[model samples]
Target: MKFATTLSLLLLLSSILVCTMSTPLSRRHSLSVIRKLNREGPFVGLITVYAPEENAFLASNAFKPDPRHPFVDLSGRRFRIGKVRGKGVVYVRCGVGLRNAVAATQQMLDLFNVSGVIHFGIAGSLENSLRTGYVSIPKQFAQTGLWEWLKANGTVGPEYFAHLDIGSYNVPEGEGINQLGHIGYSAEEFYSESGVPNVPRRVVWANVSQNWYNIATKLEGMELERCLNSTVCLPQVPKVVIGQRGSTANIFVDNSAYRDFLSKTLGVSLAEMESASVIMTSVANGFPVIVIRGLSDAAGGQDGPNSARALGPLAALNTAKVVIRFIELLPSHKKYQDLK
Candidate 1:
């Protein structure tokens, strides 16, 4: 009886061990384990915000998924690993919003040995010269959404936070791209860095990698799709415009008054929800970044002027094409120069 009982206990213990080994860990635990092992990366990171935006990368043999581990699931985000244009890449969907962008980009950086980051997405044109389907690779990015929300009286705020009049504003009905504004938007205040304490840093513009910017400039004359389908075409042929300015915030801007204010006051050519945060995160992590944006609308409150819903996909595809080409131009050596 004793022998039989001991054998039964041993079998039960073995079964429990097998079950524990077979069961997957919680997402957080999985992330911790991956972070500890750190085996997944060292590839260029391709980040997209919307599904349609990533679909472009997907459609080109869908980026030819990485044979080893095609997808890595982290909580809700699924990062796709693959090769695009013959260069290794880890693509991830960055959900909309400033926080989401920061989280996704940081996660990608943390999870991989990201040589550099290339972000492609759609934006609303603050410049009339940039039409739908036109791609703009901004020279730098500003996080304009970090406003002081000053009182109606505009009394007390940070000295650097420019006071924006919330009321009526205007610009020429239709005009070319205006120059960048001299006004000060709020700069991010960091209290400490590199183990130094009691030091504050104010960073306003996050510049793009000079190398990437130069490569993007070469694509100025590249052809882009101007139509979603046969019957639906843009007003003009699509082309690339390099070296403009873009800004990001949590706000979804549709008001012409606000749009013109941002354009004339800040010289913002393209406005979107994610670029600044992505750039900031990359900068913090010592990674080089390049942003490619396609103009989907004019950010005008008027019905016909705001065609983002219709043109978003077309714009996304145009930017994705530019991203792929940009990738082709990247040095095969992963140790690309980072932004200073």
Candidate 2:
């Protein structure tokens, strides 16, 4: 009886161990683990917000999916945007913020067996030089609870983080293709009015120039200044800048506390509704992501001729071009093209 009882206990213990091992650490993290299980090579996933305005931007060009591309579900969940060969990168529009971003990212990881993820979307500028039409890559990301949480759960730790070993995709000396980036926060507010001047350390930031034009024009007299400003399309752009961009969930332009939060925490030049969620989720998932935003409004200003709704698509189009440029220069894609 003792032997039989002992044997039964051992079997039960073994079953429990198996179950524990099978269970994922967090509900949100299962996608990464599943991705690890189905390893192939060189496939990258792109995430964007799924808004009607954003779709309008994408409508200008319908990027096709690669039949051989593993993640092209055709269910609209995942679509392919042509094959760059050896590098089978795909573009997908996941909804906005943390919850949507997390779901979209995981879906990409699980569905396509992609090797990495890249994010292309609009971000308000946080630097002066980064006008409405310019673009910025975030070198170091900043935020509140989001960053802290990602450090605890992601490949990049609390001190600072990045998933890929990104090097310059150099075009030439004083030339076209460059590895530009910046340090900015994905925050939850817009327009810092705490009376504390929100200033950013000298870090290069990227943002689309046209969007900057939209907002800067709202600043009392900026409307006329834009026509005379050529920096709007400067020849040599920096990796980043602090523009007139700040963001918030609610568009309460009268809130003093919210503005202070933007100044103190985000150091925002322009205000928008997304970025923080994207950075948090991307970092957590261990995906090598890039943020490309177009300035649709100047910091602490009203909407000009183009509202967020109108400007989103144009920004997406410009950003898409940049994404394509990066893909073209990728080593895998280059080699694949050479064979052809």
Candidate 3:
């Protein structure tokens, strides 16, 4: 009886050990298997848009949603994986804010084998030369919404609202005024060494990937649509331009004074809501990013509020066309494989 009891205990212990070995923990012990299952590779393109109009344009042009294609629903956000110009691509409508843009971009990085990102949408023209329907590929992106308070003594104080600085009046000498209150306020002129309250100006800037910039520079003069339907049209034919700075924020700017400020202060050629966020996120992930914006309105230039409504569709369509052309020109996967 004593021998039989000892044998039964040993058998039970052996069964437990066998069960543990077949579980997930044991399967994870092999490094090769873990890598093979988790590691994602090969380049998949990521295209992001912010508004419904932009989404409609992309869906009709490059990304025709197919029910057969795999669709991923994560955390109440939907991502459609499709083919664009014969290349595997994913389309995401990130909504109209910095938070949404960043979150969606990060999700793409986590779930897909993304090679690069391209942002396409409409923007208000900051540069006088960029008229309605003109497309611009910005080289640098900045946040216009960020503001630092300036004390009477010419020193940095605290943060303040950016819109408070917009207007067409001079900051009176000691009237508790904002320097950017007026158009033609030059940072270089105000912040000289001999100027009052000597402090370095604060501005954060993010640059596009050099490889992507090179590709954009070569895309100039590409055909763009300038007509709004059969009857409506721009005053002049629009063309693609490259290598300019753009600003992004949540603000929908319709004030010409602020528009001039952005152009003069930051050399911003275009102003929009989502590109800067996407660019920064791409930079953090060490992937190439490009922003192609079509001029939808003048941002309160002489065109008035109806300008965007009248021209927005044309701008979105032209921007989409440029993006499609860029994708067609991207280096083939074989080139990347050779490097590996």
Candidate 4:
């Protein structure tokens, strides 16, 4: 009797999901459903990369018992609130780096189908103004089409609503912001153990170089499309920034060339394992992108200190709070309804 009743309820919810996702959905309708009861609040996605042994993700309290579905395999897992500000708002822990970030973003889109994605995590500020505790919301990103996609429709993707500056940058006053170019995306195994020839900091430099090359190619493609369309702005060149990033791989950090390049050519702020991937995924999907990093370790130098590990979580939490506030300040859809 009890088993039958539970099964019935599961079947009902499954039917609902199927119906909701059946049509060639509209972005506004998607947002309406996502923010339905919670329309009074902001509809957002909070994603986190769960670094090994970090266990920082478990700190969130948004986990709610979700009815398990074969299509959605979060079986035994519960939805935890990575962080919540108010209505239509929720956060998810999407493991670490490109793969994890992409998967998490996809899941959030498929499940809740929110209007915006606010990736709140820590990055190593390669530059100075983006200090140990400071947060960064880089406007533009560089990526490879092989691993991901970049938005070219000029309009928001079919699944999202806002097409607000998807690719651009506004480096905080003084952080070598002028020197910025295109943000880079690197996957695991991006560099080798032994530094490359002519490049003692092979690991760091390789990741940075590869990321820039990949992004340049992607941007060139977008520029080509714009020219064909004959838009007013024939080409849009993104200002890229070199920053410190946190990286996680089997190999140890042993290259100095990355630092040399950073000091000499790029003055980057931080480096981490997953940021490039995150930026690529967000931009491709037409979602607003922000790379927030907590200083973990200084690359190519003596293993600085374990302090970054402790400080990273706090930094991520701070970033989360700021994102929520920013959403609050954005002009609500109500303001655009009649005007649009």
Q: Where is model 3 more than 4 Å wrong at Cα? A: 1-43, 64-67, 149-154, 157-203, 334-340
Of the two candidates 1 and 4, the one with more favorable lDDT, higher being better, is 1
Off by over 4 Å in 4: 1-42, 51-83, 143-256, 262-267, 300-306, 333-340
- Tens digits of lDDT, candidate 4, 1-340: 9999999999999998897778445543544544443433334555666642124433333333222211122422223332233334456566655566667666665565455555656554444344444544443332221112334333334432111231332335334333323323332223222335344321222222332223223221111111112332212321222234433332223345444343343344455555556554444444444443434334554345533555555555444444444444434434422211
Q: lDDT by residue for model 2 over 1-340, one digit each (tens)?
A: 9999999999999999998778655532434533543354446566766664356335535354444433334334554444553455566777655566656766665466554555657655444455554544443333332222222122433334222111222335335433333222333332222223454332213222232223222322111111213323323332323233334232322233333455444565444445544544444444444454555433433334433444444445555555554554445532432321
Best by TM-score: 1
Cα shift from native, residue 139, model 4 (Å):
2.5
State the C-alpha lDDT per candidate. Answer: 0.78, 0.45, 0.69, 0.42
Write down the TM-score of every candidate. 0.82, 0.50, 0.73, 0.47
Weakest ten-residue segment in model 4 by summed lDDT: 220-229
Which pairs of residues collide in candidate 1? 42-113, 58-62, 181-266
Which tens-of-lDDT digit does each residue in 186-290 have in candidate 1? 787543234246676787787787777777788888888878889778888999998899878888788877788778867889899999888878866677889
Q: What is the lDDT of residue 294 in candidate 3?
A: 86
Q: What stretches of model 1 exceed 4 Å from their correct place?
A: 1-41, 156-158, 168-185, 190-198, 301-305, 334-340
Model 4 vs truth, CA RMSD: 19.3
